[model samples]
Target: MSAPRVFVVENTLAKMAREPGGRNAEAAVKAAELRIDGVKDVSLASLIEKAEQLGVLAAEARASGESEAFGPVYDLSNAIYGVAGAFGLKGLAEAAFSLCDLTDHFRSGEEANWPAIDVHVDGIRLLATLGEKATAAGADSVLDGLRKVRARVMPAN
Candidate 1:
């Protein structure tokens, strides 16, 4: 298969560099570079493990009808978003972001679309297992699935 596209979001780095701190501009740039380097050093296996654990927690919370579970689920989705985006897992990142948005909407008194959240969780697991190469290879199909779920979960606004 062809090499996967590196999905670096330069804007994220820029935003990090622009964060308010007592440090000077050069120091901020250095900090941003270090953050990116740190992400490179992270093990993908560990990230996947964390995502799996979060997914299970989300499922259990949903099953138990715990409204408080929104916080954990939202945090899990954000974690997935960060890790996947850092690792260039664009499909997974998008899926996780959509899930995060859906959870936020639900928490804001919108109807919870549990089935759509399941689809996002499934996408996260699938992309985590497949990694970047397979994800790039199957980008079209993966994105199609995510888009369908997003449509279902998105509050009419």
Candidate 2:
């Protein structure tokens, strides 16, 4: 299991603390630091459990065949993206992001191919099973397969 990729973005709290004009800058920074610490302390077990639940939700949504299912599927994908990104599960995060986009397309009145959703759910399950042990190579392969499926379902305009 390679270490999860560390994404360093702008530290908004730190930036605000550095600015002279903001009121309660110190408190904001402290709150941000506490939030960071809490994220760091998130248990792998809990993340895995969430991932499992998401898989079930996605599968159920697919089975339901109601366009309304897109809502829950989108929400679950968002949750998976956040948790997976925090835990360095890059593949899972990427897959979830793709799934979110696909669901959004459907929500926007684009026709959805249910089989593609099934594939995405399978990819999420694979990442949940692999957890921290998931490899970038494996993730890339899965992403490639998903892209192929997406391309087939949604032909370029």
Candidate 3:
């Protein structure tokens, strides 16, 4: 009920800067970006491969009655979600995140929403085919469609 004691913690990096051996955080970020860039091509290719695999898995899973296939889809999409932004694939990351959200929403059901699953996987693969700076016509429209489909499938409750 009294005035709280507020102990201010000094910015560690600013304190370090005042010292002799401090480094510019911006330079460190640039260096880190360069390192991550080294693996960008390989990572992008792997993501595409995973996206393709997701399509096949979704088809196979529905055929085999594996309602739990959303589990693997969630895992792969989550991984894609984690890294897609770092590589500047905004659409791909958005689709991946949508997929993850859809999977989570449908996971507890007795049957998975196959059409929604297919739409997301296809959307992801399509986005993966486009480059990071892709300004392809209707790209935003595609992203918008993804959001629409997610809404249609998993209506807000």
Candidate 4:
């Protein structure tokens, strides 16, 4: 029996970084951050669209009082969280995460806390309206309110 020979390939990205004259890793990272920051406005557009869509869905769920109606809210909040976090919208990202946590509590328990969902929807909208300045005074207040709202229903853990 003959053993098959194994070939190892160096990662292209690693090789490029290690090669002489290659761009400085730190400089490349800073350059990428600048590029990402340029799209901050575009991220707000996305946040608006996502927030609008989530608002409608949450409103419907509140009206019907059906647990299943909020099913997609959790999934959509994940997308919201991703986009908000990627753009460094700290307040918005925190709000999205709180929504996700509240949604989990809503889904697990027998009765749904529709009002809490509404609170989160409103919070998200407020954060989005505050725009790219994640640390704005309004954003901080909204985030603080959301934390309290989510804390009400979330089981201590």
Q: How much is the lDDT of residue 11 in candidate 3?
A: 98
lDDT of 3 by residue, 33-122 (tens): 899999999988888888888888677667767557668878889988877888888878888999888887777674577777888888
TM-score winner, 1 or 3 = 3
- Give the alpha carbon lDDT tens digit for every residue of 1-157 in model 4: 6898889887999776677885777998999999988987887798888988899888877787767776789888888999988977888888898888877777775588777888889889878776675567878888788788777777578
Best by TM-score: 3
Cα lDDT, model 4, residue 151: 76
TM-score of each: 0.69, 0.67, 0.78, 0.78
**Per-candidate total of colliding backbone pairs:** 0, 0, 0, 0
Which 10 residues in a row give candidate 2 its minimum summed lDDT?
A: 39-48
Clashing pairs in 4: none
lDDT of each residue in 1-108, candidate 1, tens digit only: 898887855688778767887688788899997888675645567667866876887777687675667778888788878877877778878877887887887777
lDDT of 4 at 78: 83
Instruction: Name the lDDT value of residue 49 in candidate 3.
Output: 89
Candidate 4's TM-score reads: 0.78
Candidates by TM-score, descending order: 3, 4, 1, 2
- lDDT score, candidate 3, position 43: 88
- Alpha-carbon RMSD, each predicted model: 13.4, 12.0, 4.6, 4.2
